[model samples]
Target: MAPGLLDRSRTVAPPGWSRWLIPPAALSVHLSIGQAYAWSVFKPALESSLNLSGTASALPFQLGMVMLGLSAAFGGTLVERNGPRWAMTVSLLCFCSGFLLASLGAAVEQYWLVVFGYGFVGGIGLGIGYISPVSTLIKWFPDRPGMATGIAIMGFGGGALIASPWSAQMLESFGSDSGGVATAFLVHGLVYAVFMSLGVLLVRVPAEGWQPPGGKRPQEQQSRKPLVTTANVSARSAVRTPQFWLLWVVLCMNVTAGIGILEKAAPMIGDFFADTSTPVSAAAAAGFVALLSLANMGGRFLWSSTSDVIGRKNMYRCYLGVGGLMYLGIVLLGDSSKPLFIVCAMVIISFYGGGFATVPAYLKDLFGTYEVGAIHGRLLTAWSTAGVLGPLIVNWIADSQEAAGRSGAGLYGLALSIMIGLLAVGFVANELIRPVNPKHHLPEPASAAGQAEGTAGHEGGAEHKEATGR
Candidate 1:
């Protein structure tokens, strides 16, 4: 941790360096921080050991998510100003330190300390880590921004696949008591520290003037794709455009629709089959949750990469449009066929994960890579909104229905219908997006050195021009 080691200048890729090395570096940070998705694995054990209510045990994860949005939104520009290496190092320190602090809290049986440490401190790490490599990846692979982002982001979705079972085994071996929880937290902090350090060391910005082999210039790409822009928009200007808010709505609605089912997946499926001839066992419900996770992880890479070919807007049409059909299928056919139900649910979740992975590329297309990371960070406020909004809609509706003497699939019927409506709104929002106005474009820098400095550590030194409306 020398003072200059994490500086942006230190991270410039040497001439002839392969840009392909970047993805794995990005993945290292993403996979470690993606453990946030597996926080549920500790919830039950924490409740048992600390004598807490379910809501209370959930505080850490919930607060962590809130902090994730806030930190990403606020810390984004600083990330752009510094570099991915600096951001990754900061994320590693905060995330690992939070775990270590939480471990101490668990050992002392001070639940409040655990909440503050994991929720507040670790949440900062999640936000910063999530955005750290995004711009860099976009820079290194401008020709394939969608696929480049997809690879790193897919690791975030997949992190729980590794963490959940591994954490469970540790809990089983050490016991789920407070002491065991402490030990597990200690191990997690240490292990993630080592893993995330790789990202800090390996990440590099493309040297100034570098471009991918045989890649089309931004203007050439823009000729075919109307939404693609050669002009850059500062993060500040991006937020002022109608396109930004339109995308915000698109992301929020898509996430809300998908998360509604995801948060309630286990219980919803079980409830669907409760009055049927074949009841869902607890084990089967658990397996169903696992299936959703896999779909979520796989979809990130698959759908986002597909966006590179089909375009970001069309990719979202599939997510929000076909996704709505999936919800309708669930609502119309409820409990009649288990296989169909599983298939529909899996499709919805896949779209959910795809939406997350595809958005950075979407931002790059509309905003350009100059400050796309910061723009992406600002857009994540939609996710935080959806996180709260989705669960509440499903849980509240289900509770009301059950109290009204509902049974079987009837409990979630209203909720599924609501998700369809939200997806339709998102679909409309997606269709409305167009090229950003020229008025919002960042003005060209006056001098060559100044211009080069602006684009140097970013995507490339492609000369920028004032955008003319498409």
Candidate 2:
């Protein structure tokens, strides 16, 4: 045995000071970054001030989403190379700065500048912040990857819950009828900057020899794979594989279906029964939006955890297959019944959040954790694509129908048809997934794979020989 090699390995550490503490820090960043979802709250202001149509007003949010995906794809490898603390700190800066910049743009009455600030700059923050804690969380909780991801992702979903109400109050307090939105933007920037900085200060990578309280082994004591994993494929290579493109299609389709409903929630519900004796009130429509948020947030944890038990494949089948049926129900029956509409919408959103929470774990399954971040970043391109597509399908159909003097469920039939088709495409993509090639499998130490697959019982055959809790 090489004597010096053993000593060198002892010097470095794993990811965090403690896994439990990390989620709080991560939540701080996630919750603040979540204000992006609240952009809709400003929609009426943007429309009235800028004199834009529904479609035009939605452009900034769509651009931000596109930028989010693109920046993540580009920054994924960089985040892995650095660390979560650095990545998230930078995200805080960009996001806060975007708010400040948008405030200036709004005050001066330049919508393009607002778009540039919020969409491009803030979107970068969203992407980097979203991916930063993911790999670290997985390292800390390998056995419960789904659960770990669910906890953090729930913050993303819940962000809107906090922001919508808070932003509404801020607008009332600080805003004059003339420039209330601008003042609200300024306050948002200042507050988030302070809140997110605390997270940056608290984050710390684990000390040397730190492991979960009762991890399998002193990692060094075991014969494990090289410190550097081998089976990871280049992002370029990942796209070429059937798996990458398939999953890309799957994510895109799932997100597109979900976002379509989200973008049109109020109007869609209103249109569903314009023909009815009793029409939906604005308050009821708002309640529907709240319900969707609840489903989205809850699904992030519940459905993703189910993936741990059922496996990623089976879970996604539930997403696409069952999700497809849910959409079909909405289309076939129309939105005549609130019970039916609400049920379908809730199930679809749960799958929507599940799709996001499951992807990182799915990436770990296929690409190996070595380059999962990079692969994840690349896959976000599909999200960027869907961000554009989803809103377009919804708004375009609704606008076209409105122009033709149509109302009620008739306005949504075409959009539902499109959503059904997307789910079908996703079903095909899900079926196409296969494990990554063994060539990409990094060589592991004898102890790591000691008990061959299936040999390990419900209780793992040999616990990891990792060290004490850091």
Best by lDDT: 1
Which ranges in model 2 have alpha carbons more than 4 Å from their true place?
A: 1-16, 46-59, 107-112, 177-180, 206-231, 234-236, 334-336, 398-407, 442-470
What is candidate 2's lDDT per residue for 44-63, written digit by digit as tens?
77788867788777777777
Candidate 2 vs. true structure, TM-score: 0.83
Worst 10-residue stretch by lDDT in candidate 1?
461-470
- Per-residue CA lDDT of model 1 for 1-470, tens digit only, reads 56588766788888878888899999999999889988989999999999999999999999999999999999998788778999999999999999998999999999998998899999999999999999899888888888889999999988888898899999999889999999999999999999999999899887767777675554326448888877778787899999999999999999999899998999999999998899999999999999999899889999999998888999999999999999999999968999999999999999999999999999988987778889999999999999989999999999999999998899999999999999999999999999999988766551222223323533222233222221
Best by TM-score: 1
Determine the backbone clash count of candidate 1. Answer: 0
Alpha-carbon error at 99 in model 2, in Å?
Answer: 1.5
